[model samples]
Structures are given as structure tokens and as C-alpha cells.
Target chain A: MSGPDLLVLATVATLAGSGIYLLLERSLTRIVLGVVLIGNGANLFILLSGGVTGRPPIRGLFGSEGISDPLPQVMILTAIVITLALTAFLLSLSHRAMRLTGDDEVRDDEEDRRVIARVERELARHRVREEVERMRRIHAEEGFRAGLRARLGLRGTVRRERRELRRRMREEWERQMAADDPEGGMDTTMGEDSP
Target chain B: MNNVLVPLPVVLPLLAAGLRLALAQRLVRVQRGISVAVLAAVVVIAAVLVYQTDHYGPQTMHPGGWPAPIAVMLVVDRLAALILLISGVITLCVLIYAIGQGASDNDESTPLTIFHPSFLVLLAGVADAFMAGDLFNLYVAFEMLLTASYVLITLGGTPARVRAGMTYVVVGILSSVILLIGVALCYAATGTLTLAQLAVRLADLPPDVRLVLQLTLLVAFGIKAAVFPLSAWLPDSYPTTPAPITAVFAGLLTKVGVYAIIRVQTLLFPGEALTELLLVAAACTMLVGILGAVSQTDIKRTLSFTLVSHIGYMMFGIALASRAGIAGAIFYVAHHITVQTTLFLVAGLVERRGGSTSMDRLGGLARVSPLVAVLFFIPAMNLSGIPPLSGFLGKLWLLRAGVQEGTWPAYALVGVALLTSLLTLYTMCHLWNRAFWGDRGKLPERGQIIEGRRGLSGTGIVATAAPGTMVGTAAALIVFATAFTVAAGPMAGYIDRAATELLDRRAYLTAVLP
Candidate 1:
């Protein structure tokens, strides 16, 4: 009962590694398999606790001194029965999941998904609003610059700047229209929509 | 001390579960009556065990009359009896509520009959867990409860429940596996599974090995307890169940995990072996859980997240590992079980009257059902720790304990604990404003009420008023929870004594071993 059993340990590590890999997958069927694998690995762990091998814990076979403890084996049997019940339940659940959704991939909790989508949508709208604001600011600065140029008597340059500003503003307006999905968001399009 | 009561809590329910299943095909009233009687008897037994353990120090009973460290050992001390008493009452009330709901509903949307056996088994599991004297028995207790929970949660196998139950069952069994591994390591290190024996033997192990064992057990229990990093499964899974089932699960299941942590800390790895580790975890659980609560739109999910958040307070108490801290944690646990279950039950009523649990959809519930409004208000305020309530008292004691300990991490936790409380209040206030105070929004069109109580779940609707049994049960629990404030003085003293015996360990160890 002293030193560890390398073979059982190695098997457990392997089963657990593969089991965890499957466990991380979203598919219910795979997760069930992962549970089985890891469950067996855990069973081996319990068995290993009783030591690598033993003088059969037979009551009369040998003096009790040399006989390996039977508690861990008894413990594993109980664990296996539990694992069996859980596995059966999981299998039925996966079947139900498959029948309901046509696949057993776990769906996000609908509220969690709703929250994520709403947040993402709001963030996208915010970015779009900022871009339009930046564009409008540039347009205002351009108008101011074009007015100064016209006053300074550069008609061609002023006309060109004004045309360019108008074209740029038109493009920004189109983008803002698509992005303004929420109520009243489209109302904010008035400033940028002006020719 | 009359130790015979110890086994009754675990055994009576199991025997009744079998009888319930046997009678499942026959009269529903008899089945319900038997289930109720069994749980009522359990409450009386639990009460007796409480007085006996408080007076006699501790009591132990062996199944099959075998001695401890051999046949299954069940021990009742102040800690187990206190929790057992509350659990017995909660389960009884929830069962009554379920029966009331099922009897009146004509639709078969849920199998009302399936609840009888499973609920009894679940009761046995919870009782067995609180009294389990060995780690393996504790594991068995966990499996028993979890197996029943999986059934209860997925009762109707609706698309939503099936989806949620998959996650619930998978995460649950995975935790069991990890727990088994931890048990294996403990057995290998100490060559025994009894709690008292491990307490004695573990102290002599190398600190490194001891830490490994401690960390292993923590990770397993932490997942079950739904601590910060491992709590995502709770809100997602819990809200999808029928309300009564959700109430019991919310009130008792995570607390079982917390109870195990208490046992592990006090008996197995006593002293401040991982105070800093548990403190950081507690702080994170509080902050992360409350933040999750604030962001949820559905009241059920909101309460589910809050359930996770509140567990942090217990963790904070246990992490301090002081007498006052443990006492505070125990008090918080008792207060929380009643309040959390009450809140969920109220949420169920909100769904019935207000048409939806979604905050945006529910409005003017105060005017719609004054009784429901008041029912919801008390537990919600108590949960957020308003003054003259049990939640506030529990928090005050825990934070005081943390301050008295006076480590930097303890200070950080106290600060985090206060912040979490405020945010919880903020979330509750925001919920009140939207659901009860504002203009009545569009009530769900008759066709739009989404829940199916398995019978009239979504159909020929009954009166918007909650049924008498449901309302009475919820009101009874809320009153029970509020009464804690009135009894705070004596209750605190009792748990303080329980904490002393817990930290001392000798009273428990010799009681089981000698």
C-alpha cells in the first residue's frame, strides 16, 4: 500500500486527458463520452488507492496483515454504480436534446445570448455614431475652410472643397442610415444628411 | 443522547420514496399525504436532534448498527442539526406547494406524479449529506441528491429544460468525478475515509501533500458550490426548472457544497491552510456573481445569479476560519436558504400575474396583485441586506469578523463584501422600479405567457392571483426568514457555540471515534 502504481496512474492520466478534451466540446454526445472516460479514470484512481496488486483480501487465504485492503474496491463498485446511473441519465438527456433540436450541441442560455447580442449591437451602433460624428465635424471644418477660401478669392479651390465635402457627407449618410437601427437613431441622421 | 433520530432523516425519506413510487399508480392524495408526513416527521426528528446535540455535544448513529469507520456513519451535531432542521422545513413547504400547484392544474404539461418519488429521494440526499460522517458517504449523498435533482430539473423534458439539463447533468457528474478523485487521494494519503480519522492523520502529512489534498477537495466543492470561476452552469440550468424544484435546489444544493467546505476546513485541514486562497475566491465570487445578477433581464435568472453571489458571503466566513467567522457563515447560510427560496417562489407568482419575468415586459405588479408585490418585496429587500433583516445581520457579523481578523486580504474581502451588498441593492432597486413601480407595460397577451406549469402552464389561465397553497407556502417561508431578525440574538449565540465546537474539533472527533 506504500508506493504508487505507475501503470494505473498512466492510464488514468491518458483517460483523463482525452476525457477533458472531449468535455470541452459543445456536443452533448461527446460530453457524455467524456464523462464515461473520466469516470473510469476516477474508478482506476480508487482502485489504485488500494495499491497495485494484493494478496487477495480473502478472509482465510492469508493473515490479514499481508492482504490488500478491500475498501477502495468496494468504494469503486459504488462509484461505478453511480457512474452507471448518471451515464444512463446523460445518454437519455442527450437523446432528448438531439430529438428536440436535431443536434445535441449545447445552446447558449437564451437570455445570455440575448444580452450578448444586445451589447454587441449597442457597441456597433456606438462605433457607427462616433464615425458619423467625426465625419460631420470634418464637414463643418471643411465648410469653414471653404468659406475662408472663397472670401480670400480662391473660387476654384473653394468650389472643389465644397464638392468634395458634399460627396463625402453623402457617403457617410448612407452608412449612418444602415447603422441607425434603434428608435430615434435615424433622427440623428439629419445633421449629416444635408447637402 | 437519543441518536436514533440521526438515521431517520436519511432513512424515512428513502423508504417513503420507495413507497411513493409504489403508490405512484394509485391515489395521488395518499402519495402526497405520505410524502408530507414523512417530511414532517423529519422536521420533528431534526428538531429533536438539534436539542439533543446542543445539550449533549454531538450524537452518532451507525446504519445497520455497525460502529463508525465501518458501516455508514451518521453524526448530528449543532451544525448538522441546524441545517437539517431548515432543510426539512424548506423541503416540506416546497413539496406542499408542488402538490397544491399540481392538484389545481388540469394540464399535463408536467408529470405531477413524477415529483412524489424524486422529491422524497432528494430529501433523503440532503439530509444524508448534512449528517454524513465519512467522505465516501458524503459522495454517495451527493450522487443521491444529484441523481434526483437531474430528474427534478428535467421533469417535463421540454426543449428548454432538456437543453439546460444537459449542462446541469454534465457539470454535476464531472464534479462528482473530481470529488471521487479527491477522495481517492485522501484515501491514499491517509489510508482511511472517516472524517475524524482524516483529521488526525492529515495533520502529520507533509505540508506539500496536504496542500495538494486541500486544493483538490476545494476545486471539487467549489464547482458544486458555484464559486466565481465555476458558477456559469448555475444560472443557466436552474431557471429552466419548475419553480418549486428550483426553490429547493436553490435553497439547499449549493449550501450542501458550502457545508462540505466548512467540514473540510474545520475537521480535515484545520487552521489557516488556505485562507488567502479562499479569501480571493470569495471576493471574486461576490463581485463576479453580483455583476452577473445586475446584467440579467429575467427575474429568475437574476435570482439565480444572486444565489451564486450570496454564496461568497459563506465562503468569506469560512475563509476567515475564526469562531465568529464560522458562526456568521452558519447564520448567513440559514438566513439565505429561506430568503432565496422565497424570492424564487415569488418570482413564480410574478410570472403568473405579471405575465413575464423579463423586466422590460413586467410592470405595475404592485397594483396588479398587492399581495404578490408585498411577498416579493420582503425577501428581495432582505436579500439585498436592508436593516432589521436577517441578511443585514448576517453581513454585519461576517464583515465584523473579517475586520477583527485584520489581514490585508481580509480587509479587501470586507470591502468587496460591502460593494457586493450595495450592488445587490442597486440591482434590486432597479428591478423594483421596472417591474413594480413603473407604468404597467403590455401584459403578455393570453397566448404569450411562455411558462407551462405542465398543465395550465400556458393555457386556459386560472385567476391571475397565485393559488392559496403556493402563496401560503411562500408567505410562510418569508415570515420564517424575517423572524430570524427577531431571533437574531439567541440564534447567533447558538451558532457561535456551534462554531466553537467546530473549531475545537475534539468534541466531534471523540464523539465519532470514541
Candidate 2:
């Protein structure tokens, strides 16, 4: 990349970094600024992607010294207009929001946020249950295979060893089941023996 | 045959509004009559253009005989013509109502007069948006509508109205800006601004870049259409406007956004990502919007949420990226514009007779004005997807398309849609029970609440006119909506044809550039 391309890239990188930082801030104005900066960064990236070099690509300005790719420049113009309109509107929205709610802080709608959190928690719970069930099935299969080998006379296993294996497998299954349940433990397990 | 007619819908309104502003010295009736005549003419012309386009395919008229690639191309297809037709017809009804309702005073009329022209310009903007052949032209069309809408939303400049309008305007402007940026990026990526040409060239770019371009366009359109997360601005802002204006905006503005989404999806980037994003957006939008509607106490606000919720249904088909899906979406658009507008119009009538739009302030209206109740019932049922109504048919078609897709997401979306439909009825029932029935105890005395500025001067007359015209205008709109219900079959076929035309861009390309 040449001088201008490098400059554009640096500008884009800085804008992107700053934009992300601002977005991470809690204030609505900073968030808006972040969005605007991100947009500018996107524009710069587009400019670099066009891969054009030399003079600005306007008609009748520079005839023979060759032309920079006009495509990205044209695209940038449209981007600029759109960005300007969006930023201005966002600024006004920020002002209106401040006036109406009496704050520029990014206040959340309590009801909506509560609903979303509930939904997320439910989904996460379902995922955890599925994962625990899979682990239990794997453990049961491994124990059953080991017993089959012993029954086929491949190893000399005492009664104590068989009992211990059974107990361990049962314990693992119980642990898996309990892991899936968030409310302490399953009620069905309350009257069960230790084994 | 000049593309001039394409701009007429927008220009006539703009010019009339400007004239109304300039001719402040003129009689109020004269100004009103002139505005009415102008809008009526626009409606007639739009109807004719729609009919003609039906028979002749899409019409492309270039202003000043300028060729594409350099000059602006005004395109009028069946889709645009239909929207223009809707806008024109609604405007006529609203104007009649405006006249019958009469002015509140000189200051109100001055602002009100601005409404006539602004409304006309809004039509023009819709036309321009629908007919725009290039990306930049689309931006301009969007600007035209946004500017006009800002004026309409805060027409009388009430503090609440102003605050609401400010949010609306800001959101609208931001969306436009986003769209413009996308357009610019598009032009830079591909040396052409024409949509058809971009459609062809965009296909050749790297997948990543193309994805970005498609997403940029989608985000911009999505914001305008108020899909899911981007739709927060609509509920508060839309309900703050007067009933008629709210009716028109609710019916027309977001649909324009839907229209653009359709155009771009069908024409430029026909991809899985765009389609998937649209589907996800549709699902979320429906669930959230209806849920919001369910919780609202104000009838206008409730309807506004429903409007957002129903938009997802239309997006359902567009997201499907199939002929049947798009057709269903097209039919849904027409059905929704009429039904939604009529609902808002009735809301205005209810507010007038019952003293407030809040359910808490009003009750037993069905017992008092059975006519208004009957008028509101059909569309309410239709909106909730009752069988044998246009809403039901539109939903049925969309559901069939979803089932045909048989994808897990699509199936889930169908379920969501059905649930949303049920909940929609639940909310509408709440409105009906609270507004149309319930104990007659302590509802604000009829006509006593005085619309604040538009209160009656003497014996239910305001500003030297009676409200009979307002009622008549609303009744006409209701009748038109009923006709749409009656003609659902033919309307569906037309929508299918329009969808086919949109997907097959050969004609659209040849007409505009050739």
C-alpha cells in the first residue's frame, strides 16, 4: 500500500478500535459516537479494498497521469451521505431521549430485559440437561462393556470388584443427573440409598 | 407516457402543500377543496397507472429523455402502482375527514393546511421509492417521504407530538443515512448505481464483500421496516400523531421499507444469509411487537405494535426467497395497508366519540355507537387472521409456504406466527371489550373531552364545519377495505404476478435502461 492507502488503513484501524471502546461505554451518546466511528471505519476499509492509486478519479481533472480506482471513491461518496444522515438523526434522537427520560444514560426497559433474561436462562438450562444426559449414557456404555469382558472370562474379577464397579457407575450417573438439575437436587433422589 | 406521471404523485402533494403554505390569505374551504381535488386527481391517476402497468408490464419513464447511467429513471411497476393507489385512496378519505372535521382555529389550520400538501408529497415519495430504478434514486425517494412525514407527525406541534415526532424523524433520518452509505459503498464497489446492473455485477464480487454489501442494504431496509430490534422507535412515535395521519403512516411508511427489502432481496443479493437474517428478523419482530401490543392500554399504541408485529408476516415470505413466499408477502402488503389504515381511522373515530384513545378513559362505545363498533370489527377480525377474511387468507398462504419450506427454522417461525396471531386476537379482544363494551360507569362524557385544539365551537360544529364528512370519509375507507376482503382471490393472483415480475428482472432492466 502507498501513502494514502496506508493513511486510510491507519485511520480505519484507529476508528474501529475507538468505536469498539465507545460502544463498550454505558452512555447512549458514546454508543452513538461509536456507531458513527464504526461506519467511518467501514468506509475506509472499502476505500482500501478498491485498490486504486494516483489522482482522485473525477472526470476532466487528470487525463493521462492514470486514475485511482473511481469505484471506491464513488462508493465512499454515497457512504458519506448516508453516514451523515444517520449521525445527524442519531444526535437528534439522543437529544430527544435525554429530554423525555431526563437522562443520557442508556437505560434499559425493565420488562423487556427481564423477559430476555428469562428466555436465555431457560435455553441455557435445556442445553445443560442435554449435555449431562449424554455424559451419563457414555458412562453406562463403558461400564457395560467392562462387565461383558469380565463375564466372557477375560479377567478374574472378585465379588467386591464387581460391587465397587456397580457402585461407581451408579454414583457417576447420579452425579450427572444432579449436575443437570439447578434446584439443589432432584426430589426423586431424596429417599434413595447411598449406592 | 412521460416518466413525469411517475413523479406526479409526489410532486402534486408537495406542490399543493407549498401552495397551501403560500396561499395563507386564501379561504380555508378553498384551500381544503383545492387540496382535496389535487389528491383525488393523484388517486385517479395512480389507479389508471396501476391498471395500465398490469396490462403493459412495468413502465419506465426517464425524465428529460435522459438515459440511464446518467439520468434519473422513474419506474412504475404493478407493486409501486398498487402502493401509490393505496396512498392516493387513503389520502382522499383522510382529506374528506379533515374537511368535515373542520379546523380548530387559525393557527391549527395553518399547520393543518400544511398537512394536505405534505400528505400529497408523502404519496409522491412513496411513488418515487416504489419506482426508483437506481439506488441513489431510492435514497432520494426515502428522503422525500421522511421529510414529509416529519411535518405530518408533529403537525399541530403538541409537546408530546413534537417529542414523538423528533424520535421518529431522527430514527427515520438515521435509517436513510445508513441506506445512503450503503448506496455509496455499492457504487464504489461496482461502478454503477442502477439496481439491475448492480444485481449482475454484485454476483461477480468476492463472497465476503458481497455479503457485506447485501447486509448493509438489509440493515438499512430493516431499520425502515422496523424489524425486531430496530423497531423500538415506532410504538412511541406512531401513537403520538393524530389518528388520520397515524393511519396513513402506519399503513404506508413501513410498507415502503418492506417494498425496498423485497426489491433488493429479489434483485441484487439472492443469498442464504440475507434470507436467513430476514427470517430471524421476522420471527423476532412478530413475537415482540404482538407482545408489546398485548401489554398496551392505549388503543392507538396497541394498534401501532400490531402494525409492527404484522410486518413480520410479510417479511416471512420475503425471507423464504421462493415465488410463493414472495407472492404471499406482496398480497400481505396490500391487505395490510388497507386493514391497518382502516383500523387507525376507526381509532380516530373512537377517540372523537369516546373522549380518549386510552381504554381506561373509554367504555360502552358499542352500546353508544354500534355503527362504529361494526365498522371496527371486520378489520379487527381480519387483522387477527379470522377465516374468510383477507388477513386469514394472507396468513394461510404464508403458512403454506412455510410448511413447504419444511426447514426447522421455518417450521418454528410458522408456530411463532400462529401464536402471534392468537395473541393478536387476545389484544384486539381487550380493545373491543374495553372500548366497545364494559360497564357504562365513569367513561369520559361523550364529546366533552374536546380534542383539545379541535373541540366543537357550537353544537358539535368546529371551525364552521360538521364532522359528518369525517365519518363519511372513514366509512368509505371501511367499505374499500371490505371490497379488498371480497376480492382476495384476484388480489392474490395479482400479487403473485407482481412477485414473479420482481424476481425476474429481465423486463425491469430492459424497461429502465434500454
Candidate 3:
């Protein structure tokens, strides 16, 4: 029935805030640290939920009326154990990752990278096709629109548009080749972009 | 019998896991036998629990005869029992498949000693989550299963598994922490963690406070359930693991989250109005998930995305919040767990015989292995909700429930669900054409597909013929999925009654507290 301690609440907030910030980091070690902090914060918050009574929860050692709620403490202990297990597991996993790749930063999955590259490559091809289609349309309509464009003095704009399309098609083809780079040197690109 | 069976699902596997670990690398065959035996026993117990809970009522068991408000209580209601039975069947079959795979490949990457123990522990955690009558115990159950999954996922410690496991672990931890915070808040508000007790007390709180508590719990479960944008990690993480591990995780892990959402939404906040929010989440999850699935070239990743997509169907059913809707949700969960697991197992076969799960590299599997083709075809069609399949029946139930609800959002969700089904069908056709029907030698892009991507180097894979046990196990699950269609009448009836029992919170309250 009593109010929760403000100090405890503030501490929980700080720990959780920092923990989450660190959690958003790409480094596995930092994420591990973040998880640990957040876990402790959660434990503290749960403890606070039981209401702050400095008295022991033991019924006989302390008057029953003044005894703390034991359930949250018990739950916190369980949480601590689970968090500990997870921490150890994460550390070992990070160590393995570090050993393999010389750093523990979580890398983008190869399959996901492939999927993205495929998307980019497909988009590039689509753009090239669209440009080619536009060129074909321009060619097909040349007999009709050429004289109108000449009279309108719009030939420059048409020529400019065609030149731009050709440039875009060439650029897209280059990008498609880069994305299709067989070794998937995705490392040079996606390593920095991975979440 | 209820008392004996209720805790056994959690306890039996846990105890066997300890014994298996003690046996260690020595007596590896014996260890495998123990896991199969333990999971089989759990499946039987779950089946009986399902029948008992349905016939009698929700059955509750408290540890050490402690008081209701604080003690860890396990309840096997109709929903829990049904999910437990289905997951038990899944884990058992997947275990058999894993054993067959391990026996054949002699793959050292997934050291059998760790695999069986981790798998059994995951089984126990799943059972406990299903039967957990208290919120805190549910948290523990989530941790237990997830930790086991963390091990299973990173089994080989390969680079791909590690990278994938990192995202999966981080996301999982984030959800678990949120779930813990939710549990703490619930306890703070209600002065107890027992769900039945909370069901009574939560109603008395201010509406705003209740809404806050409800949204908090929903977000936590939504992440676990892989509701979008929360679903981004699933397809990224799931496909990197070994076949059996991925099958079990895909089939049961996300569904566990869905099960939790169903439990809390129905039991903890029955009258609370979050239908609009849930409907939006469901629609986005369906659309985005299927779109992602359709775009994936890898068979496993596509199936993983579809797994996320179909979860939206269950969510749609839950959002409807009617008896039919709830029934549909339960039925969909049952059907999905079986079908999804079967599909993943088949994907494993595709990876083995066809030399890759990537469609670009895999071809002519129908000719290479007719059995694998048939296996994949059945579940793939079922996943797309083919007319005669259980998936279609489950979707029809939801669509009917949505129309019955007769709201704009409900109509939107129904349309989204229909579109998702079609998209799912499209993915299946794409998979069939690229992986099964097309000849590998004739693939135009076969030379250009990423050859150096570590795992997807299907171009030069030394193909391994799948063992009979693995194929037969997958086939058994396919038949089981098919059986759901044949018995859709009885299954629907059972689910309908279960839904009623769930909505009538008074029954759960009285049964647990009496």
C-alpha cells in the first residue's frame, strides 16, 4: 500500500535507458552489457514493485505486519539466474564470433545480404529495361513527333532526356554488375550497414 | 490423473534432460533414446490432458500446496492442452528427424551430446509455458525455452549461425526484458502474479491503467510472436540453423508467443478494447510478411517469412474477439504448427537432395527425389491454404468470423488475410517452379548465383541422400496435417467448445481458485 521509493525508480530508469542505448549498438559485447544492465534494472524494478520495506521478509525474524513481500524477491532471484545463464552464453558466443571474424560486431546474415543484393540488382535491371522501353517509344514516335518538336524547339529537351536515359541505363548496368560481383564482396558494403 | 499429468509435461522432459546430460557423449545412442521416450511420454500426457480438460474443465496444479496468490500454479485448460499436444507431436517428430539426420550425416557441427539436452529442455519449457497459470512462471518458461533455443540455433557455431543467432538473441532478450517489466507492472497493480487472480483484479483498475498494462503485455508478446515490424529478425535468423532445430523453432517458438498473447488478451483483458490496434498489427504482419516471403530466393527463409505471415491470421482471429474468432485462432495455431513444421522438414530434404534451399541453385528435385517433391508439395499447398487443406479451413473460419464481426477494420483484416493467402500460394508456385520443376542444368542464372556465401554455395554441394527415418518422419507429419482436413468436423467442434470455455473467464477463475 505504501509508495515506491523515488530513488529506486530513478535508478531503474537510468539503468534501463543506458542499457537500451547500449543494446542498440552493433557490437555483441556492448549488447551483452546492455542486456545485463537492463536485466538488473528490471530486477530492481520488480523489487520496487513489492514495495520498499527495509525489513527482512522472514515472518518470524521480523514482525509479519512489517515483513516485505517475498514473491518479487524470489522472482528476481530466478530472473538473475536466467540473466546470468544468458550472459555466459552470449559472452561465449561473442567470443566465438570474435575468434572467427576478428571482431564481435554482429554481422549481417549472408542470406539476407544476398536477398538485398538480388533486390538491388533486380531494380537496376528494371530501370535499364524501362529506359530501353522509353528509347523504343521515342524511336517509334520519331516520325510523328520529330517535326512538332523541331517546330516547338523542344528537340534539345528530347535529346537531353534520351541522353539522360542512356546514362542511367549504363549506370544501372554497372550497379547491377557490382551487386552481381560473384565473391559478394558484400563485406565492403554491408558490414557497415548491418543492424 | 490431471495432477499426475499436468506437471509431467514440464517435469518429465526436464528430468530426462538432466539424465541425458549426465550420460553425456558416452551412451550417445541411449541419450537419443531417452529424449525420444521423454517427448513421446509428454505427447501422450498432453493428449490425455487435452481430453480431460475438455471433458471435465481446466485442471490446476500448485507446487508444494502453496497459496493461490503466490505459488507457481500449472493449469491445463482446453487451449493449453491442445497446443501442448500439437507441440509435443511436433517436437517428437522433429527429434526423430534430428536423430535420423545426425545418424546419417555424422555431422560434428551439431554435437549430439548438446543437441539432445538442449532440445529436451526446450520441450520442457514449452510445456511449462502452455500450462503456466502464473505470469512469473510464464516468464521463466520463456527464458527456459529461449535459452535452449539459443543453444540449438548456434549449434554448429558456424559464422552464419553466429551472426543469425546474434540478432535472434538480442531480439529475444529485448522481448524477455519487456515481458519481465510487464510482469512486474502487473504484480504491482494487482499485488499478485497468478493470472486467474489478475483476471479478477485487473478489471477493477482504471481503464487507462488497464490499457497501459494491456499494451505493454501485447508489445512484449508481439515481439515474441513476430508481429511486424517486430518480425524482421525471424527470417534472418531461422534459416541459418540446422534443419530439425529450425523446424521445431519455426513451428513452436513463435506460436508460443501467439499462445501467450491469446492467453493474456482473453484471460487478463477480456473486455479491453485493443481490437483496432491488433487489427492493424495483423494486417501489416500479413501483408509485409508475405511480401517478404515471396521475394526470398531461399526456401527456408521463404518458409520462415510465411510462418510470420500466417501468424497474422491467428492475430486476426484473436482481434475479432468473438467465439468464432477465438475458435478460428485456436484451430489455426494447431494447423499451422503441424504444417509449418512439415514444410521446414521438407525444406531440409530439399537442402540435402537438391544441394541447396536456394531456388536459384536448386532444380529438378521432383525428378531427383519424387518423395521429397510430394512431401514438399503437400505442405506447401496446405500452407497456401489450398481449398481442401486444413489451412484453408482455418482461414475460412477466420474470414467467417471477421464478416460476422461486421466492422470496417474487421473487413480490412479479412481482405488482407485473403491477399496473404494468395501471396502465400504465389510463393509456393515460385518454390515449385524454381526448386522442383526446373532442371538445374537449364537454369540461366545458375552460374551467377552467389557461390561464395558460405552456406548457399549450392553450385558445388556434395549432395547427401536423406535417410529413411528423416523422410519418413516428415511424411508422418504431412499425413497428420492431412488428417486435420479429414477430421475438420470434430476438430472444429472441439475448438468451438474450447473457445467458449476460454471466453467464459468465470470457468477458468472458479476452476483455478476453487
| TM-score, B chain alone, candidates in order | 0.97, 0.94, 0.95
Residue B244 local lDDT, model 1:
84
Q: Best candidate per DockQ, number? A: 3
Number of the top-ranking candidate, with TM-score as the measure: 1
TM-scores for every predicted model: 0.89, 0.78, 0.88
DockQ per candidate, 2 decimals: 0.25, 0.04, 0.30
Single out the weakest 10-residue window by summed lDDT for candidate 2 chain B.
B456-465
**How much does candidate 1 score in TM-score?**
0.89
Q: What is the C-alpha lDDT of each candidate?
A: 0.83, 0.75, 0.83
Give per-residue CA lDDT, model 3, range B476-513, as digits (tens): 99989989999989888889989998898877898888
Q: Is the docking of candidate 2 incorrect, acceptable, medium or high quality?
A: incorrect
Worst 10 residues of 3 chain B by lDDT: B452-461
lDDT at residue B375 of model 1 (Cα atoms): 93
Runs of candidate 2 with Cα error greater than 4 angstroms are: A9-195, B1-4, B104-108, B271-273, B446-466
Give the per-residue lDDT of model 2 (tens digit) for A1-195: 578778877998899789878867767688788878877887787677566577877778888577887766665676677667767755765665455445565544323433554565566556556555655565577787654553444223334444555565566445433422223232334223232
lDDT of 1 by residue, B1-514 (tens): 2367689998999999898777656776677789999999999999898898889889998776676667668888899999999999999998888777776565433365667788899989999999988999999999999999999888766666776788889889988998999999999999999898899999999999999999888989999999888898998889877778888999999999999999899989887548888888899899989998998877998999999999999999999999989999999999999999999888877876765677977888887778989999999999999999999999999999999998899999999999999999999988888899877786654344333223223233343577899899999998899789888888888899999999999999889886
Candidate 2, residue B309: lDDT: 99
Clashes of each: 5, 11, 0
Query: What clash pairs does model 3 have?
Result: none
Candidate 3 true-interface contact recovery: 0.47
lDDT by residue (tens digit), candidate 1, A116-144: 54665566556556555655565577787
